[model samples]
Target chain A: MRQNRTAWFFLSPSLIILFIVGLVPFFYILYVGFFDWNAFSLQKGMHYAGLENYRRLVFDQPFINSLLLTFRFAVYAILVQLVIGYVLANLLATDFPGKWFFRVIHTIPLMVAPLAVGATWRLLTIPGFGPVPFYLDRWFDFEYSISANASQAFWTTVIMDVWHWTPFVTLTMLAGLTALPREPLEQALVDGANRLQVFWYVKVPLLRPIILSTVFIRLMDALRTVDEVWMLTGGGPAAATRYTGLYIWRIVFPKTDYGYGSAMSLLTLYFTILISWLLYTAIGQQRRGER
Target chain B: MKKLITLVVLLAVVSGFGLTANAQDDNWWATAAAPYAGVTLHGVSESTPPSNYAADVLAPQFEALTGIKVELEPTSWDQMYDKAIKDMEAGSGIYDFVYIEQDIVFSYLAQDYLVDLTQALVDHPELAAPDFNFDDFTTFIDDFKNAEGHVFGVPMEAFVKIYLYRTDLFGDPEIQAAFEAEYGYPLAPAATHQQHEDIAKFFTEYGEENDLDLWGTTVQAASGHSSSFYEFFESIAPTFGVYNWGINEENWKATVENGGQMNSDAAKEALAWWVSLLQYAPPESTASTWDEVAATFAAGRAAQGWVYGENTAWIASDPDRSQVVGQVGVAIPPLAEGVMEAAEAGTGYVGYYDGGAFGIPHSSKNIEATLLWLQFIGQPSVQPEWAAAGSRIVHDATFDDPLVVEMDAQTNGYYTLLQEQGYLFKGAPAHPFHAQVRSVVEPFIWQAIVGEITAAEALDQAAAAADEEMARLGYGQ
Candidate 1:
């Protein structure tokens, strides 16, 4: 009982800080979400909105479109990043000349700030001045205008995300691969399995947990992506890239509709939590099956 | 005893000379700001030329004269507004002075976010400087007044968006001959919508045939940005004889069926005309804001464009910033029939008279110090140099200043046009729900710009959305 009291005393400061900084604001926002509020309106203050904000959310086409777009973007980005990262991880597993240099270069994009990456890509893709458009026009006569083409803008954002995060995925998979026991792979090779078969059957299964966790992390991070995409296209080309994060920002900041923004943000938080729980459950179940 | 008396006499004579020196000139700031000396005034403004001048030039001068340090943070337009509004809403007193843009001032006033300068002067006469006279400012200052004619902000800068064209292209004999032969009209500044279209087409083809890196015009048509909405409504729609975002002020409805012109035939026509200009604009036009449009014009990539007047002086005179220096010409925007008449009769306007004013927020901790800073910047003495540097003239006296007259000559009579014809232009309407209505309406405009919807369809949807949003905001029931 004394030891337990000592532990509680030690943890009290963090618990109090968390309550003040984190939980207090969270609960306050949750409370505010049920009211019609504009911070600028001194007279009106916060009216009792009941479930009106939530009801309006169901009919908010922009919000719906943004949520759908973010999901689509996350799925596409994760699938692409996983494939590319796994391939890079596999290639880096082999002993090669100047491997460290290539690895360092590959990891450079990961180290760059998202805003800087977005800015660099913007400089590279600007219509007349940017090298991407200049070279594309010179070589293939293809008109590469992200601002004009919605598909191009969306895909470019995906590509930028891939560039930014593929390194992280690769490193995670590589760590998993290096830690795998050599016995199963050696036995599989001796049992008449080809290299492709060995990789598909042995290496992939061993890396499954790492892959799932990587995907889970990347998925959550991608859903909340705003800075890079904002700097790149500002969720433009007719809201082609207006993901849920950017949409909530538009509501909260520019529109100053705090109630709707809070409600939508809470909905987004719930969605992310649900997704993470599903992934966590799947990983746990897989571990149990392995045992 | 004799030496001590001589020393006292000498000291008295020196003190008398010092007093006379102090009383020689009108140093009102030193006296007015004496009580507030040593107080640091925090301000936030957009990083425009005028605001930069306030921070870089005027702040130091004000500090030197009054011993009150001014810390002005110049930032991007959106960020500035966000920070200022957030600070005021929180009642944090973070910003002693905030840039109240013409469009957003009504919202600030509605929220009681700013300290009333006129009232402050009335309450504390000691804080009012002799050099600071509100009547010295042009009618643009009227936009910053409350319902009772009490001033809220000191007008820092005000300029209209004007039509800018390349004089070289318009004056070249070969190009003029070709344009006449192709379009059956002499090449000059466009005075009508059809003429503007013809000029755009002619210049585009002219560039294509000559293999020149040039387009016909510049368009602020970013498919997902508020700048596009502003361009269409404030600059383009007015030329089509639509005003006040086409919402009927009486009913606060934006649809034609509801007696609002937001979705009227004229506005649709205006949108169609603006969107159609995409082909003639530089490829980057689709991604452009007012900044990029000015850049396009400065690079001599566009033959003619509706450019904000704040960029006029630099684009026409500063060789380092503009390739079209000495070749840029300023003119009125091409208008539809009877639009000019309506503008002249004071019932409507041509293009946006864009500007902002510095106001002490209600939450300011150092209101008196900020008021002194505001009065210091508002004096007619500071207007000439500022106008010369920024191409923004807010005071009536600034128009006749020698420095501005020279700059007017350099910018091809831009100041002359602004002084003579500025009254025809107007700022945004006095709507407290300005941003709320814009947020709802701009997406449809963006959709139209990106070809997801037709002009008619976009405005139809936009008008309906605007009316719905306005009603939700309790503007009209």
Candidate 2:
């Protein structure tokens, strides 16, 4: 009982902070989710909107469109990041002169702020006047302006996410490779396996956990993407780039519709939680089977 | 020891004189602010030049005179609105004063978020400084007053959107001859939509043939941002004979079917005209904002376009800021043939009058101290300095100030245009539903801008969405 009391006492401060900052806000959002509350309106002016907000969310064209776009963006961005990270990790895995310098240089994109990346890309991608476009047309016979069309802007944001985060995946894979047992690789080589076969059969299986973690984290962060979209497109070309997170921000901040926004936010949270659970379970089962 | 004593005495006398000199400046209202000297009055405002001046210059002077400390927080536009509205709505009393833009005043007033300055003045006459003369303000003061003539805030900054063109391009004899031959009109300040279109087309062609890095004009249309919507409805629509951005006067219905002209034929034509100009504009036009638009003109990329007046002074006169400083020309924004007629009927405005004011929110903890602060900012002596910094003038007298006069000469009477033609323009219509309606309607404008939908289809869809939104808000029942 004394030990339990001491443990409880040690946990009390964190518990209070969590309750105040996390659980309190969640419950309040839950409460507001049932009503129609505008910030500038009076309490008397507020109405019990009930499940109307949620019901409308199901039918809300913009919200549904944004969700679909966000999903597509996440899928493409993760795929590109995984492929690029794998290539970079493989290249860096070899011992060479100036290896550390090259690795650091490759990670420079990841170090940049998202807004800076977006703004820089926006300038570079200007169709005629911008240097990137100007040179591409002159040297490579390629011409495209992302801001000129919706679909184009969507793809550009996906490309931007890939460019910004591929280094994270590369470093994660590098860490996994660094920790790999050399015995399995040597044995695979003695068994007459080629370099490719040894890497595929031995290194790949051991790096599964790290790969899964990197993919899942990037997916979640991409789904809630806001800053890049804001700085680059402002969710423009008719909101083609408005991911779920930016849409929620538009609702809560500018529109001041806290009730509807809360409902949408909670629904988003539910989706995110479900995805996380499924991924965690699936990965855990795979690990157990391998063991 | 004697030398050290003499040095200390000399230092004391100099320091004392410096204190007295500073004290005399704010002494006019020092006694009233004496009790509040130690107290800190907090405020939040967007990081505009006027607000920065208030933070860097006015705060220390006020603090020294009254003993009240002032801490002014300057932040980005979105954060400024968010902090002020959230604090006011939650009744947190975190801010003693807040910046209120003319565009958002309708909503602010509707929520009763601000104290009635007229009533505050009556309630505490001692808080009102004698030099805080309300009449010293220009007609723009109406932007902060309710319909009942109750002043809710004090005007701080006011500017208009005006027509800016390149004199170098417009005055070239060979280019003028080519324009006349091609369009059957002498190239001058555009008076009709056709002329503006012709000018844009001529400039783009001229730039292409000569291998010059030039375009017809810069359009402040970002396909996905609120900036595009503002340019379309506020700046472009008014020129096409659409009044009050097409919201019906009597019923506030935004749809054509409901008697509002928000999606009227005129508005459609206006959108079409605006969208067509994109082809002649630089490729970055689709992503262009007010900042981009100003930069484009400054770089001499655009021959002419309607630009916000805040950038007018610096862009036209400061060679460091503009490559085309000597070649910049100012005029009224181009109007459709019948626009002047509609504008004269008081049913429409020539352009947007962009300005903001400072008001004491009802949730303020220090209303009396804040009231004095508001009056201090309103004095005529402070207007010229604020005007020079922000490129906006709140007092009529500031227009005649020597500094303003020099700027007027440099920019070819842009200030004079504001003084003479300002009466022709007004801020966004006073509607509490401004932000709400704008959020729902702007996507359609973007759709049109990006070519996803025709101008007519975009407006039609926007009108329906607005009708539904208004109904959902319990309006127009």
Candidate 3:
């Protein structure tokens, strides 16, 4: 009884904050999704039209297109971040001169805010002013203007995300490497196993849990990404790069369709939760199989 | 420890509320004005010449005359809108007067969020002086007035759509002779839809033949506010005879979908002709915006452009900004055959529509002072002042003034041409659904221009979507 009281006392503040800032507002948004609430006419009583907002989303072409773009962006972002991050992690785990310097430089992109990174990249990609296209044309006899094309926009955003967050994944993996038991790795190395065989058979198997956790966390973070795209193209040339978050902002702020925006937010939240749960379950199953 | 944290959080919240309340009360207009004892008036404007020029020239003059100190707050257009909306919504008396766009007058007036300036006009007759003829103001001002006929604001800057072309490029003897030979007329600024298409085609084909990187014209198809697609559509929608709302003189109900007379054969022909001109525009024109179009023209890449008359001032302000500064000529947008016929039949000239007006927010405590400032700005003396400083003044008397004309001539006759061609004048249909309809039609028009969709397909989709949106908004059947 005494332990239970002590635990409750410690958790009370967090519980209150979670209720006020998170759970309460989230539930409120869900309720708002059932109304026809225009922000411009906030004083007027909202009309209740249950599921109408969802129905509109189901029929809206732009909404569906944005959803597809977001999924594509996420898949590309995860794969690129994982591959680059793992390679960098492996490189850093080696005994090399100037290793600390290289590690520090790798962390530089992560230190800058995503908005600054996006802006810097946008300046670097401008056709006349930027050097990337000019240099590429000189060397490869090819020109690239990603901002003007939809498919290119998707790849550009993915590349930017990889550049910015690969360091984060690398740092996490490095920590996992240091905390890992060295005995098994050393035994495998001494048993006439080659470097690749040792890494693939022993080290990679040990890093599985850490890798899954990092991927899951990064996936969750990437789903709500907005600032980078907002600053770079504002989801344009058309609505080419518009993610669900940008779409929500357009509906809520510019169009003043708060009810519709709420519906979109709820839908995004549901998809994110579902995806995270599936990821967690799959990772758990994989770990069990490995054991 | 928990109690302490809770106490700190509560205190922070309370202090935040207190500070907001205090800040609202501390602003200039909220406090009572010191009568004749040197009152301080707060004014807000964008970083334009008129606003900046007023701060330099007129503020001091007003202060000397009334013993009122005018505090000018200069901001960019985007910042100005954000700050104005925030202050108005909060009922914070930060500004005694604000410069605002005329289109948003409906939103403001509908909310009863502006002071009625009708009494101020009646009381101050001198402000409506020898040259400030209210009768000469555009008929659209009535649309801006409240149900009680209260004039909430005055029209300040007048912007109109005009065609800007490079005289040097078109004046090439060989090209001109060939164009005349082919089209059976001298190739001057296009005066008809057919002529516009022919000229665009000629320039585009010329560039293609020479393997030049230049385009015939730059048509903006960018998404969002200030999209050229909307401007292009507006310029020709009237010529096409398409009323935004169905025209019913007696019943007063919109019947656009029911094949009303307003949606006549003339309107469809006009739209089709305008759509056809997109063929000669740049391939990337569908993604270009107003700024991009302006850049293209300034880069000497485009032979001709359909742009706002205000661009003349923008280009003339900085020599480095334009390659064709002294070489550009202006003309009214082209008309359709039906529009010409209607004009011959004594119908008033139909043209694309635009307006920019000023208003005092309903929450303003200094309504009287704001009205006085509005009237002062619209005075005959001030009209010339604005004109001299390179702003397009709407007052007829200002346009008639010898000094205004001379000032315009000095600026390479840009103002003179703009005034003569009736560039500041507009006659597009006015409906509450103007913004909404533009949002839907702008994108589809862009798609059509880019060859992503056929003109007929674009129109059909636009009309259907517009109809659905109108119905959703309870606008019309």
Candidate 4:
């Protein structure tokens, strides 16, 4: 009883904050999702129209487009980031000259604001003023403008996600690499295993937990990415890069359709929870297998 | 005991300092208005003031006049709207004065979020000049009053969309001769959608041959409100006779379909013409918003660009802002074939849309002070000052002022185009779901422009969606 009381006292502040900022608002948003609420109206009264917001979402073409785009972005971004991060982590674990410099360079993009990075890339991709298109035109003879093409916009967004966040995965895997039990690696090395075999057999297997955790984290971050895409193409040419976050923002701000926004947000929350559950299950399976 | 007393006293002093800092009212609004003396008025703007014209000018001037202090709270356009809506919804008095878009006033008014200014104007008659004729305001300004005939807001500025072109680029003899030979008319700013497309194609082909790397025109195709797509569409809609005439007399619902009266055969043809011009526009135009379009013109890549009247000052004042500042010329948009036929028969409507207005909130504590500020801002004495300082003013008398006329002439006769074209400017319907309708329509219009869907299909989908939304909101139906 004493231990429970002490624990509760220690957690009291966080619990209070969670209730006020998180739980209360979450429930209130759910309540709001039922009504036809416009954010700018003078009337505070909300009429109860149960399930209307959700029903509308089912019929909303744009909302569905945004969801599909988000999923596509997430799949492409996560797979690319994971592979690149793992390779880079393996490279960094070895003794190489200017390793610190390379690591610092890798980390720099992560430190820069995502939106600023997107804007900078946009400036660099402008037809004549930007050097990328100029160089591409000069060398490869391929005249391309990423801002104009929807496919190019999608790829650019993927590349931007990799550039900004692969460092996070690299750092996580690096820690995992450093923390691995040396005995197994030594035993494998002694048992006539080659360097490649040892790495593939021992290091990667042990680093699964860290890689899974990093993937989960990146998955959530990728789901919420709006600022970079917003600054770059703004889901444009025609609804090409509209993410879930941008959709919700349009609802809450421009459309002032908070009820629909909340419904969409609740749906987003459910998806996020499902993703988290899957990650947890995957991690648990990997851990149990290792045991 | 002595140490405990010392600690308590120190804590008290620290808390006192924090409280005092939060309570300080150093702005001009706090010092100027008699009723609001020692009270701070938070003023928010969508854009940062130009270096030559900062809030300090109005802050000090207002303070000296009214003894009230005004604190300037600057934010980006999107952020300002978000904050304004949140504050208004919560009934939080965080902002005493807000600069909002004209289209949004209906939604704000419907909510009773804005104060009625009729009584305030009557009570503060001294604020008005002997020549402070409300009649001087155009019908565009007068139409924004609430249904009860209460003036909720005063017109802050009037901006009409005009076509800006580069005289130097089009003045070349060879290019001019070729254009006239091909189009059977003098090479000039386009006067119709067909003319505009022909000119754009000609310029794009010629410019490419010359290695000039210039576009014939630029239009915004971004995904948000205030995207120039709407303005571009609006400029040609009247020419096509595509207009939201009014609500149905019996139904009281939005009129979008019914053989596309607003979304008519002519409008679709106009849209197709616009889409064809995209080939002449810079490839990046698909992602361009209003700011990007402005930048495209400023960069000297576009031979002609559609822009608002206020942007003329923006281009002229900053050398770094535009490459063809001295060389730019303005003209009213051209009439379409349908409009031309109507004009030949002496029956056509040539109208642009007004952009923004200013209003006091219903929760304002100093109505008289706000009214005074409104009258002062609208005065002929202050109108030219605001215009000269790079903000647009709505008064007709101000346009005739020597300084304003001289400035306009110096900046390539933008004022003349404004006065001629400004009178024809109308506003969109003030229904509550108007904003929602815009959101649904804008995206699909882009889809149509990009050929993801046909114009007719996009219009039908948007109309059906809008109708559903209006019905859901228990409006229009």
The best candidate by DockQ is 1
Model 1 agreement with the true structure over A1-291: per-residue lDDT tens digits = 999999999999999999999999999889989988876443368898999999999999889999999999999999999999999998999989999999999999998999999899988998777899989998999999888789999999999999999999999989998899999999999999999999899988888899899989999999999999988888988899999999998899888889989999999999999999999998898799899
lDDT per residue (tens digit) for residues B1-477 in model 1: 999999999999999988876554246677777788899999999888889999999999889899999999999777898899899988999999999999999998898888889989999898888778999999999999998999999999899999999999999999999889988889999999888889888888888988998999889998878999999999999999999999998988999999999999999999999999999999888888887889999999999989988889889888988899899999999999898999999998989999999999888999888888899899888899999888999899889989999999988899999999998999998888888889889999988988999999999999999998888777768
Tens digits of per-residue lDDT for model 3, B13-118: 9999989864553332222223432767786766555567677777776665555677778775445665676577667978777766555566566555666677
Which tens-of-lDDT digit does each residue in B1-477 have in candidate 2? 999999999999999988886566457578898878788999999876678888999888778778888899998777798899889888999999999989999899988899999988999887878778778889888888888888998987789888899988889898889899988879997877788888998899999999998999889888877778888888889988786767775776889989988889899999999999998998888888777788889988999998888778778777887888778888888887777766777767888888889999999999999998888889887777667666789998999999888888778888898999887777998777778888889888888888889999999998888777766665665
Would you give me the overall lDDT of model 3? 0.66
lDDT winner, 2 or 3: 2
lDDT of 4 by residue, A136-165 (tens): 888999876664566776888898888888
Number of the top candidate by TM-score? 1
The DockQ value obtained for model 2 is 0.46
Model 2 DockQ class: acceptable
Stretches > 4 Å off in candidate 4: A39-44, A126-129, B1-32, B48-56, B64-67, B123-140, B223-228, B245-262, B316-318, B338-351, B363-372
> How accurate locally, in lDDT, is each candidate?
0.91, 0.85, 0.66, 0.70
Fnat of candidates, each listed? 0.58, 0.64, 0.04, 0.38
Top model number, lDDT: 1
Q: Rank the candidates by DockQ, best first.
A: 1, 2, 4, 3
Model 3, position A105: C-alpha lDDT score: 95
Error of 3 at B471 (Å): 1.3
